[model samples]
Target chain A: MEILNLEGTEDTPKIILDKKNGIFEISGRSLPEDSAEFYRPVLEWIEKYSSDSNPSTEFVFKLEYFNTASSKLILDVLSALEDIKGMKILWYFHEDDEDMEEAGQEFSELVEIPFEFKTY
Target chain B: MNFIYDLHRTMMSQKLILVFQGDFTQESTKSILSMAERNLDSSGEESSIKRKVFNVMVEALQNIVKHSDELVDGQVRSHAAIFLIGKEANRYSIMTGNPIRKENVVKLKGALDRINGLDKDGLKDLYKEIIKNTTISDKGGAGLGFVDMARKSGEKLEFEFPEMNEEYCFFCLKVNVPRDNE
Candidate 1:
């Protein structure tokens, strides 16, 4: 499958899924009216990529804010990464944004993947 | 109107700072959200507090856009809704009302009650459980909107059903998010 690239909107996130480069990232605010619909393809991409597997997959999430619906979709993404080998999730947040930091921690707990917390 | 004075006093006493009453398409609601964030920033609210208010506000607005009764019982409700944000010394309140079919009132109330009854840990478990067990509703709801609001605000969600007509009522929801000092 080709890499999935989507530009972020006011209520969506920027998505970059490149299996060859081993770069999987989704960042920005995700509060889409139809989050499930918006995230369907991303989840499918994860499903396809995990089968082939990458030696060092970097899954990065720098979501400033995401609604509860998007939160579920995010957790699903994290869970899918569990099937991949050499997985590392880099969770990034602003220095003063404790909520985002905590969200990173909470999400990391849902999947048994190596996680790194980065602050800007 | 005759009771206009009372209404003024009510808002003033509550420190109601922002009020928007009209149709809210998803596109228009984005601007309102931006304005609300600016209001919080200018007021010197803490970053976490602003995030909490912003999150709850987004949920409330989205709920209205998704669930408000544009038409109920063969009658159009005009798609107009009301949203207000109030700030006191240390707390912020977000209130929203929209037309809803009377039949949905009970279910919504029950959900709010269940959310209000949970502790922080309980809410977290419930959130994870629901997300794990269910997919989003056609309206893009995982049934976690109210739960997330309650969790972020760290307060019970308050709601009421004011009579609008026989078949539809104004479903009013109010949430209070108290700021946490780091």
Candidate 2:
């Protein structure tokens, strides 16, 4: 498995997926214009990772802000992760932003996989 | 001409305004929104104000990217549109306008009508419902963006569809944000 790294932008975020450590992190603002384009590779990588089966895969999402399109993509990412065995996802939300916290909780409810929400 | 000038002056007096014309792709929208964020951050504005401007700007620009009628080289472009942000007394106002296809007017009307009918609580429920039921469309028109915008703005979303031609119309939306002092 190979790692994926993308720099964060004013409207996007930095994505660091470390295949060696089995730790995937997406952090920063994410309002990508072509969210499909921006997220396609990450989703594909996760799909590939799911099949290969790491002992334990930890996914981290630390987003300051994201638009509606990005929100949908996030859901897609979570759903993809849910299919993988031994996958653990941790969603970090800013303490000051109730909206973001609620969004994480909402996603937890929708997906069957357990999602741990942590405030930073 | 004088009336136009007066209207411009009046708008200027309200708050900061940024307008975009031509192609408004995802990259361009990201740039514009980032610029706004940078400006607000440098100015040391209140978080509430910053969030309000950010939410409204995102919603308006995304709408343009998804729905604008004019296309340039196969890409959707903003046609005769304006985006304005103004602070009046203690409140901020965000407004946007763009040309729309006549065929899409009915759907746009339905979207806005559903948005307007919802109160904050109702909008929240609607957003959750839509998010759960609607498949993520390529064009980003799950109708949840408008609902989220309205809920965040804490203001009634206002819109208009003026007849422009046999095939197109002008659609406009205005949302207000109350300043912290208010």
Q: Which sections of candidate 2 miss by over 4 Å?
A: B1-8, B13-16, B70-77, B138-142
Q: How would you encode candidate 2's per-residue C-alpha lDDT over A24-111 as one tens digit per residue? A: 9999988876777788999998888888877877789898888887777888888898888878779898777777887888788778
Q: Which candidate wins on DockQ?
A: 1
Taking the tens digit of each residue's C-alpha lDDT, what string does model 1 give over B8-34?
888899899888877776886898999
10 residues in a row with least lDDT, candidate 1 chain A: A102-111
**TM-score of every candidate relative to the true structure:** 0.90, 0.87
Q: What is the lDDT of residue B4 in candidate 2?
A: 88
In model 2 chain A, which range of ten residues has the least summed lDDT? A94-103
Best by lDDT: 1
Q: First chain of model 2: TM-score?
A: 0.95
Candidate 2 structure quality by residue, lDDT tens digits, B39-87: 7788777875777678778878888877664544343356466666665
Predicted complexes: DockQ each: 0.73, 0.47
Question: Scoring model 1 with DockQ, what do you get?
Answer: 0.73
